[model samples]
Target chain A: MEQRKATIRTACVEALPLAIAIAAYGLSYGVLATQVDFNALTAVLMSVLVFSGSAQLVAVAMLAGGAGLTSVLLTVVLLNLRNLLYGAALADGLGPAKKWTSLLAFGITDEPFVLASSRFQKVGPDPLYFAVVAGIFYIAWIFSSLTGALIGDHLDPQKFGLDLAFPVTFAALLVPGLKGKPVIGTALAAVLMALCLEWFKPGNELTIIITGLLAPLVGLFMHRRSDHG
Target chain B: MVNQWILIGVLAVATYVSRVLGLTVMAGRELNPAVRLYFNYVPTAIIVALIVKQIFIPSGGHLVLSLPVLAACLAGALAILLFKKFLPSVVAGVVVGLLVRYFL
Candidate 1:
């Protein structure tokens, strides 16, 4: 029992920083979702139900850009591909959760994955630790979304530059991880490809999905070359 | 509104399936390394794409480069790179963006 308490404490301490980051982004997501016409209820509920930050943020951004349901769904699927990798990676640590893995599966996004993977490596199959970290993130996400949405509701999007918040917030989220040859190459490729697509046909619905599917191949190619060289 | 709910429902279902599939069925097996790398790169690619899409907004059937958005993004990226802080970087970005939108 004492050991379990120690694990929970450690998880809270470790997850706290990432949980704060999650809340910041969730607040941004909440604000952004409202700009796209999500009421506070729906915005927070999405956080409650979806619990995938990247997918949620990107979906709201795309909707603001006039993306339709099919387009947004396709783009979100592209974003969620990493969750497959995260789930596979975390399968072992969450093993003891058994049937409850279904509930735990909802938290299989990026931050929790990083924290839980490291925790499992150190402590070995601590489902409680994963739960603790995910719980903190979940609480942070839900409440932050509601708060941001409430704030967003009262504001004028253009006057306050709320529209620009989408990309700027994304920059804050994405820039730190811009490490390594392949990742850098992928981002550069995405930028160029998206520009070309928009130039060819501005506001094309397929631009995001196509660029998303194509740019990663550039990264994959870079990864392959690095391996050979 | 209805579409919003539908989008949420679909996203919830698809997201869960991707996760649960990996956990339940693909648990013991190692996915192809290339496939794994591709998935890892997807978020970066899509995020960059989203940023690009916003920076170049379509207006009147022509691409309009929104300087405020681009500058704010650059400022935010710089803040994160320099301080490694989340909320402050976001604030920096929004402040810079607001200034750009008003003055430039």
Candidate 2:
């Protein structure tokens, strides 16, 4: 029991920083949802149900851009392909939870994936830790969206630099993980692939998915070559 | 709009299925080592792509660098490397980005 407490406490402390960054995006999502004519209830409800930062934000942004439902769904599907990878990798860590795995799977997005994977790596499986981290992020996302919706169109997101939070938050999460040659090679490859995709057809929706699928091969090759050498 | 709600519902279900499928299907199985390594590397690849996507915006069919976004991302990356903290790094990045946006 004492060990469980320590695990939960550690999870919370680790999850807190990313949760703040998630909240910043949540607030922006709420405000954007409203701009796209989503009622405050719907805005908050979307956060309640979906709990995904990228999908929710992109859904609203595409709607605001006058994208149709089919297009939005297709794009969201592309964005969500990574979740399968996250879920698969997280499956073992969450296996002991049994029925609870379904409940925990909701937290299988990027930040939780990072936090949970690290914890699992360090201490082995601990569903309690995953639960704590997911719970904190869930509360942060839901409430922040509500706050942003209630604040409504009166405030400007850009003026306060809410827009910058997305990339900056990602950068903060990403930089810590850039360890070793293979990983650095993978990131650099991803950058090049993304830039090339964007250059070819600017704002291409497939850039992330394609880059994600392809870039790591470069890292794999580099890893193999270094091993042989 | 009713359309928005329907879209939300579709998205919620689709997203949940994607999230749950992997956990359930792969839970007990031991994956191939190479596959496991690839999965481990996937997040970094996706994140780098995401950051890059934001920093470069296409305008009139040409790629242009958004200096503020690029600067902010660099500042945030540097801050995190220095402090090993999340919130402060984000704040530093956003503040620098905002200054660039307003002053430039």
Candidate 3:
């Protein structure tokens, strides 16, 4: 019991910083959703149900651009392909949760996956920690969406540099884990691949999924080389 | 109205299925060591890609580097390196990025 409390406490502390970043995106999503003719209730409902920043933002932007339902669905499916990678990576860590893994799978996204995977690497599987982090992010996402919807276009996320929070938070999370050649090589490879993909056609939909699938091979190759050498 | 509801419901189901399928399919299986190592490096690659995407915004179908975001990322990276902390580094980065946005 005491251990569980400690785990929850640690999870909350770790999750809070990322939650704020997630909220920043959520706020922007809310404002955008409203602009696309979604009422505050429906906008907030999407957050409650979907809870994906990229998908929600892109879906609203597409709808605002007068995209059809089929196009929107197809794009969202493409955007969410990375979730498969995240979920597969996280499955072992969350396996201990048994039946609850199904429930917890709802929280499998970028931010939670980063934090949860790092925690699992350090101390092995801890589903309680994953649950706590996901729960905090979920609450943060919904509340911020509601606030953004209520305030409408009055809140410009970029004006306050809320847009910076996402990358900055990601950098903060990433910098510490960059150790040794394989990992650093992987990061550098990802950067180059992403830049190339984006350069070829700016804002290309395939950037994330393609980079994620291929960049890790650089790390794997380096890992093998180092082992043999 | 009904169309919106149906769209939301379809999306909700599609997203949930994507999330659950990976976990259920991979959870019980024992992955090869090389495969596990590859999975371990996946997050770093993905996170770095995410950061890069944000730093370079698309404009007129071309990539335009955002100085404020780059500065913010650099500040955040340096702060974490110096302080060995998370929240303060993020705060520092946001403040630095905001100043850049307003002043320069």
Who wins the lDDT comparison? 1
- Residues A119-138 of candidate 3: C-alpha lDDT, one tens digit per residue: 99999999999999999999
Top TM-score prediction, candidate number:
1
Q: What tens digits encode model 1's per-residue C-alpha lDDT throughout A49-82?
A: 8988888998898888888988888988888887
lDDT of 2 by residue, B1-104 (tens): 33977998999988898899778775567767666656667667777877887898778999889999999999999999999766688889989999999899
Query: Candidate 2 chain A: worst 10 consecutive residues by lDDT?
Result: A58-67
Question: What value does the lDDT take at residue A129 in candidate 2?
Answer: 91
CAPRI classification of candidate 2 = medium
Ranked candidates (DockQ, high to low)? 1, 2, 3
* Total clashes in model 1, counting residue pairs 3 or more apart in sequence or in different chains: 0
Cα lDDT, all candidates: 0.89, 0.81, 0.82
Model 1 interface CAPRI class: medium
How close to the true structure is residue A11 of candidate 2, measured as C-alpha lDDT? 87
- The sequence of per-residue lDDT tens digits that candidate 2 reaches over residues A1-229 is 8988888889888989888988877876776677777778999999988999878876775565355777667657766766877888788888899898889998889888888899899988888898999999999999999987887556576677766766776787789889988889999999999999999989877776687778778778778888889
lDDT of 1 by residue, B1-104 (tens): 33878888898898888889878877888799999999899989889989998898899999999899889999999999999988789889988999988898
Screening candidate 3 with a backbone cut-off below 3 angstroms (N, C-alpha, C), the clashing residue pairs are: none
Candidate 1, residue B53: Cα displacement in angstroms equals 0.9
lDDT of 3 by residue, B49-91 (tens): 7788889888999899999989999999999999987667877
Clashing pairs in 2: none
Sort by lDDT, best first: 1, 3, 2
Q: All candidates' TM-scores?
A: 0.97, 0.74, 0.63
